[model samples]
Target: MFTRPASDEYIRYQNQYISIVPEGNIIELLERQQDDTVNYFSSLNEQQALYRYAAGKWSLKEVLGHIADTEAIMSYRLLRIARGDRTALPGFEQDDYIEPASFDTLSNEELLERYTSIRRSSLSLLRTLPITAPARRGIVNNHEMSVNALAYVIAGHELHHMNIIRERYNA
Candidate 1:
C-alpha cells in the first residue's frame, strides 16, 4: 500500500502529465479506479459504449481497448525503469493506436474484460516493485520521466479519457 505524498505546486508543475490522488492510500486509489471503471462500463449498453463523438473519433469500445493497451505499455515501461533499465522508451500515438477499424467489432463486455485484466496485471507488477525503483529515471517520448511519474501518468490518462467519454460521447 504505497501512499502518495501531498501535492506541492512545484512537483505538480514538474509532473504535469500526472494526476494527484490524495496521499495515504495511492494503491487504494488505483484499485478504487479499477472498480469505478468496471461500474462505469457496467451501466452502459453496447450502443452507449460504442458511441462515437464524430466520424473520425473512437467509439467507447475503442476507447476502452485503447486504455487497456496503454496501461500495458505504461506498465511495461514502469517494470523496465523500476528494474534499473536505462533504455529510452518509446511513446505511442493514441489516435494511431485506436485507428484501423478493428476494435469496432468488439462488444462492451469484451472491452471491459480486457480493461479489467490489463489493470490486474499492472497492479500485480506495481505491487512487486522495490521501493527504490520508484525513484529511477528514464527517457520516454523524448522526455525525462521517473518510474513513479509513469504510474501517475497511467492513472491520469484513464481519467482524462473517461472524462471525454462522459462529456462528449455521453457514454
Candidate 2:
C-alpha cells in the first residue's frame, strides 16, 4: 500500500516518541526482532521473571509473555488489514488478556518460540504486500489506521517493550 512517505515532521515526531530499530526493511526488522526478543527473554531466569522494578509493574516473565501475546494480536491485525479488510476490529485490555495466564510458570524459551513463530508468519505475509497495500486504510479497535503506519507502530511497540525489559526487568 504505497502512499506518499510520511511527512518529515510526522516522522520526526514519531522518532522522538519511539526509538525505532534502524532497519528500513520491515521484513528484516520483524525477522531480526524475533532473535532480539528471544535473546531478551532467554537472558532471564525464573527468579528474574518474578522480579519487578516497582510494585505496580509487571514481572519479567509477565512482560515477556505480554510481548508474545501482543505480537500475536498485532500480527493478526496486520494480516487482516493487509488483506484489504475494512471491518472495524475490537480492542483488548492487556490486564484482561493476562489475567488467567500463569506467566511465572512459563519458560522463557517457550515464550520466545511462540513469539518467533508469530513473527515468521507476519513477516511472510508482509513480504507479499504490494507497495501500495500498506497505505490502505482500515479500522482496527474502532480507530482508523494505515497498514503502513501500523507496521511502523508494531516495530515501535516492540522497541518500547524491549526498553522496558532492559530498564525495568534487568533480565
Candidate 3:
C-alpha cells in the first residue's frame, strides 16, 4: 500500500483537503472515489443538478466540472514532477476557470461523461508511474510539492467538493 504523504510534502493550507482522505492506498482510494463520484452525480435529476444552495454559488454541474478540471491539473503536475521536471508551475485561479467554461450549458449526463473520462485518463497515467515517482518533488503555485502530495490533493479536493455538494447543494 502507498504511504500517506508527509506534512512537509505539501503546503499547510492544503491540509484541510488532504486531511479529509482516510488512510489507505491512495491509488485505490482514487479509483473508488471515481466510481462513487460518478454514481452520486448520476443519481441527480436535471433540476437537482442545477440547484445551488445559495446565491453566488456554483451549481452542481459547475462543481463536477471543477472537480474534473482540478484532477486534470493535479495529474498534470504529478506527471511533470514524476518525470523529474524541476520547473516551477504557475497556479490557476479557480474562479477564472469556472466563469468561462460554461459548465452549466451541458447536460448533467455530458458533464458526467467528461468527468469520468478525465478521471479514467488520470488513473491510467498514475498506474504507469515508476515506483520512485511519488518521491519526486517540484514547485507549483510557488509552493514546493511532491508527487504523492499531488495525488492526495486530487483525491482530497474531490472529497471536499463532494461534502459541499452533500451538505449545501443537498444532492
Question: Candidate 2 overall Cα lDDT vs. reference?
Answer: 0.70
Answer with 1 or 3, whichever has the higher lDDT. 3
True-structure RMSD, every candidate = 3.2, 3.4, 1.1
TM-score of 1: 0.85
Which candidate gets the maximum TM-score versus the true structure?
3
- Which consecutive 10 residues in model 1 have the weakest lDDT in total? 1-10
Considering every candidate listed, which one attains the maximal lDDT?
A: 3
TM-score of each: 0.85, 0.83, 0.96
CA lDDT, candidate 2, residue 114: 72
Off by over 4 Å in 2: 1-23
Q: Model 1: per-residue lDDT, tens digit, 1-171?
A: 243423431134434446434454556667998998899888888777767799878777888888888888988888888888888888777778777746778887778888898898888888888877777777777666777776776787787777888799865
Which residue pairs show collisions in model 3?
none
> What clash pairs does model 2 have?
1-131, 1-132, 1-133, 1-134, 2-131, 2-132
The positional error of residue 44 in candidate 1, measured at the CA in angstroms, is 1.7
Give per-residue CA lDDT, model 3, range 36-116, as digits (tens): 998998898888888889999999999999999988999999889989999999998999989899988989899999998
